[model samples]
Target: MNAHHDHTGPHGASPSGDALPTGTTGFTDEPQITLRGPAELADALPYTLGFHPTDSVVLLALHGERGRFGGRLRLGIPRSPREWAPVAEQLAECLVEGCERRGSRPDGIVVFLCQDPGEGESGRRVMERLRPFAQKLRTACGALDVPVYEALCLSGGRFWSYCCPDSDCCPPDGTALAPPGTSVMAAAAAYAGIHVRGSLRDMEARLRPRTARATVIGQERALDAASAALVHRILDTRARKDVRDDTIRLARMLVDRLAEHPPLADQDTSDTRDDALITHEEAAELIVGLQDRRTRDRAAEWMEGPEADHALRLWRALARRCVGAYGEHAAAPLTLAGWVAWSTADEPSARVALGLALEADPEYVFARLLHQACNEQLDPETLRECLRGEREARAQAGTRHAPGTRATARAAGARGVRRRLRARVGRSRGTAQGAPSTGPGSARPAEASGPGVGAHTGRRTGRQEPCGTRDGGPGGDPSGAGGADGSEEGSAR
Candidate 1:
């Protein structure tokens, strides 16, 4: 969580009592795949789970051949759910694909580097995104027949970067370099500096093909516990001279030990909410139970099979695990299982999952990363320029148009149009004309005017005109020739 460390997690912690986890795996980012070829896939028992042994310990293998083999570390960056939201989505997609190709889900995935170096807060936002990602892989992989049987969160961040990389044993590009998710994916692949001595069984064929396998160290007790829960009591009495019946019978039986049976919580049936369908406990429980390759594969199938509709729900449920410190993000486990689905199978559901994550927590960087990464992929330079232009335009517009100015603009435009119309009408109606006539029944201005009449200067009354009459109005003079022989209105016209 500190964003700079090589070892500091319950996961992948050293067997020794050292406060900081230290192992030969070394604090370094390794290329996910340095080996990819027909031979690699062909020799790999093609979908077989791999285990690697070192110093009387074990690590998971990404790919395999007939017996077992190992592959490079598939690493990625942990971005703020807000800062890297859309990009995070894209990153998830890439990781999912990469995992599938690995022929196994990630033996473990580090979703985010603990921001709190002392305490990683794999918070709700983080796990919310992760849970569905895992469930989706399981569901889609089932259809492909490419199975990822075992998966779990492997080792978490180590405060490796804080140390001087110049130190002979210091990790390369791990704690010292940029976070693995973004930079490593963007760059070419590189192997971890810590060399590995692979376990080779001397089973010789003319073509001694090889692949990678991993066995988790220190997690055996937990894994074995899960294994017992998963392994059902199946009786195959018909076969087996070499395989003894009830090997359990040979061992001493403890009368007091009772089988633990956690009740299966019924899934929600209504399905009305916009949130993910699965409960947090459900996703965690499913992930916890998936301790081995076979179980892992089964979980994946459960996701895609008849339970496909619940895939989103399951993801949502699992993501809730991130609320506490131990799960800040559910990346460790989901990443481990998703590798095989990523590389070998196509996962549309998983790819679309970023949107769901953002919906759950828009401010989360993991969600934002989806859109950003996607748009950048479309055209990075163009999008940047466009974004800048849009920002500037918005800034300028803010000054020119105050809030509520929309109504003002409309009013002003309307008023101006009305004024122009009024002026045009006034001009057509003749405003510059002099006061003209008084007729038989109307008051008139003093004027002497006829059909081809005179000017309106100093005219006192219509009676001044030739045809003006007293009956016209008081303003008219009785004997005035204002309209002497013509109708007053005609004269004015």
Candidate 2:
């Protein structure tokens, strides 16, 4: 994870036998501190990933003689023994080849196998069980000519090194890990204002499926009611403009409300306040209303300034409300959450939200595109610029005929309004004109010619009523199929 090098000297004896200090720094401008042994490295893992990695394999790429850390990759440890080799090989190839692509081949690699002990099992036993997998990893990297500098197993509050042979330091029972925040690395990180939030599990919990059955049932019911009420308004061709404009207006109102009550510093309090501020019914209505692609795209304009943070909080709160049978309905809110997080430079949360979005609906086009962009490490500014340009264009067009004599003004305003409407219709039609629909309800669009994020939108057909409707009746299964991740039911996918 360290992206920079330092000239700091080690004050203590390095871990005996090939456990050289990881004398590398990350994206910070501060001087690097040295990690002498398994203990320090174990402590450094959280700092590296911004959260403690659990049941994961972390590969640290070491460059040159000083072993300056280069790139780092982490993946959930494969549970099946048969799959370990392939995963190891893939990890090795990705880190090694990826480094080479950037003009430097890693001279060495450091591997950390982190897993907690099962009930009644000791840390040593966990380490023993993972020995083969660690070996596979080392061998995989070695095959690419990048020797594993150190291979360590961290479990049961202790660490065991497979590469270090010094029994005094890396004992057979494993070395007790240094207490958190006591290491030189921790001190340096603190000096730089870098804080490791908590375990990855803790961070992900905020976005995970809530299992409170009653709450989920209520939200599902609300969703069903919202769907029943809004489906016709959203799909009726004659009312399309009104519906679209209303969706946008409601979205703006919510953003303004969120802006008035920004999140408090205490996360739990902030979340509670957010959930309380927006009612279940209101949240459900907006969630269903956002199914329109155009509506969601228009709302995406709330990307920066004070409104952006509040907007992000709103999306997150909505995401949390997407419970149980309404899980797939999370796609829109989750995508918006991810987009705002990414726009705000919170990559970890962005990746987590976007990944969960895919889990909710694998075929969700916006989620897929955002996930791909995030994984590829594309600059968020690229997408931000596109959105900003679109917003600016819209603003300029709105004011293009602001001033004139009353009669002339009326004519110009009418003509200007017509021009804008035509432009909007043309853009929508151009994107979806002849594209085939997906399944029974969804439609696909060609990529927009102008710069934008998603190449296609998933548009559900107007012919079918929203999922909760049965035989054209309002009363149907509350736990029915639908989505609220980003846009309209019949939007371009």
Tens digits of per-residue lDDT, candidate 2, 108-153, equal 7778888889899999999999999999998999898878867889
lDDT of each: 0.25, 0.61
* Residue range 108-152, candidate 1, lDDT tens digits: 322212121214543333323343433443344333433333222
Choose the strongest candidate by TM-score: 2
- Cα TM-score of candidate 1: 0.18
Candidate 1 clashes: the total is: 115
- Give per-residue lDDT, candidate 2, residue 379: 53
Q: After superposition, how far is residue 369 of candidate 1 from its true place, in Å?
A: 9.2
**Runs in model 2 lying further than 4 Å from the true structure:** 1-30, 231-241, 401-493
Q: What's model 2's lDDT at 469?
A: 14
